[model samples]
Target: MENYYVFIMMCILLILLPGPDTAIAIKNTISIGKTGGLQTMLGTCCALLIHTSAAVLGLSAIIVKSAILFSIFKYVGAVYLIYLGIKTLWGLRNKEVAVTDERKDEDKYGSKSCFKQGFLTNLLNPKVAVFFLTFLPQFVNPGQDTFLPFLLMGATYTGLTALWFIFYIYLLNQISAFMKRPRTQKVFEGITGIVLIGFGMKLALEKAQH
Candidate 1:
């Protein structure tokens, strides 16, 4: 029970940590409104669900053991991050913060794009794959006899993630009056672009340890 409590706390803190996923979510929320943010959250949750299942099925361990496979994943993930960073930076020039944009049919396409971005942004991140494989096991009960504990913990984390992002998007939307200002938008977008690029660089330099 104590381990379970610790596990929950650890997951909460990790999920709330500032990172590429959160930045992407914020960017989507501002660009396409709450629908964008919700789609982003959905994509990330789906990615996590897949990673958890992969871990359960021992696929994650297989990736770790094969250096070539791990390297491929790492480079793909790293390149994707850098690509996102560059794309976000490019969008800064055309900044039209949709806090007040007229709703249009085209936004559905944009939302689908956002979903793919979020999905790939999460899915391609090898660190997340490794985290699922390594981190949760640390908090699993030593005497546990069933896979039920992991399933429950993973589901809890995924649900918490959905709730957290929904609340986060709502709060950010409330600040449209402030964030919609041209200067404010520039400053925020500029920072997001830089942070994303930095994460990309970090990922690029990361090494996979077996």
Candidate 2:
């Protein structure tokens, strides 16, 4: 459908724009490697599914209606983003530290931790949920009297997320050798933290659309 293509194009443009999700992906990729980045992406995609379901089921409308509830989530998301930023920035001085020979043990911890981090980072952000609530409906034609369009939109969005993240993973893999340098990794983490905080701040200030 021509409308579907237009919707897809819009989604791609939105994804290409710099945002917390992209910043998180980059940060994870440079610090931990492709697996870490991919894991984070997977978590974000899972969050998207939850958001999509909320939107379709009308739960998001309830959230949007309750200013107190919405504000609570907004602040929580903001705090989490700021916490991540501070943590990353604080680690800047420790950049040159090498992965100890006990890296094998550390690696095990890192794998599970990375996956959780990825999932929680997106999951805890209520702004992302609100965003989908606001964003996805614009393309829907209520007159159609069919759910097929929404299904297509959801599939397209999921595919776009996967594709973009894959591209990020590939690019990060290519530069992973350089990223392994402690100083480089520190800078990368710092940037990621800052970007996430910025996104969080922006979300905190976002007013619910009427």
**Candidate 2 Cα errors over 4 Å, as ranges:** 146-148
Superposed model 1: Cα runs more than 4 Å off = 96-106, 143-146
Q: Tell how far residue 52 is off in model 2, in angstroms.
A: 0.8
lDDT by residue (1-210, candidate 1, tens digit) is: 238877888889999998888988988787677788889988888888887787777787888778888888888887887888788789787656563353464374768877887888888888887887788778766786426665777787888888899999999889977876778767877787888888888987888878
**Cα RMSDs of all predictions?**
2.7, 2.3
Best by TM-score: 1
Clashing pairs in 2: none
Encode model 2's per-residue lDDT on 97-179: one tens digit a residue. Answer: 56463356446665565666666667666766666667666777766643455556766787898899999788888988888
Alpha-carbon RMSD, candidate 1: 2.7
User: How many pairs collide in each candidate, listed in order?
Assistant: 0, 0
lDDT against the true structure, each candidate: 0.80, 0.73
TM-score of each: 0.89, 0.87
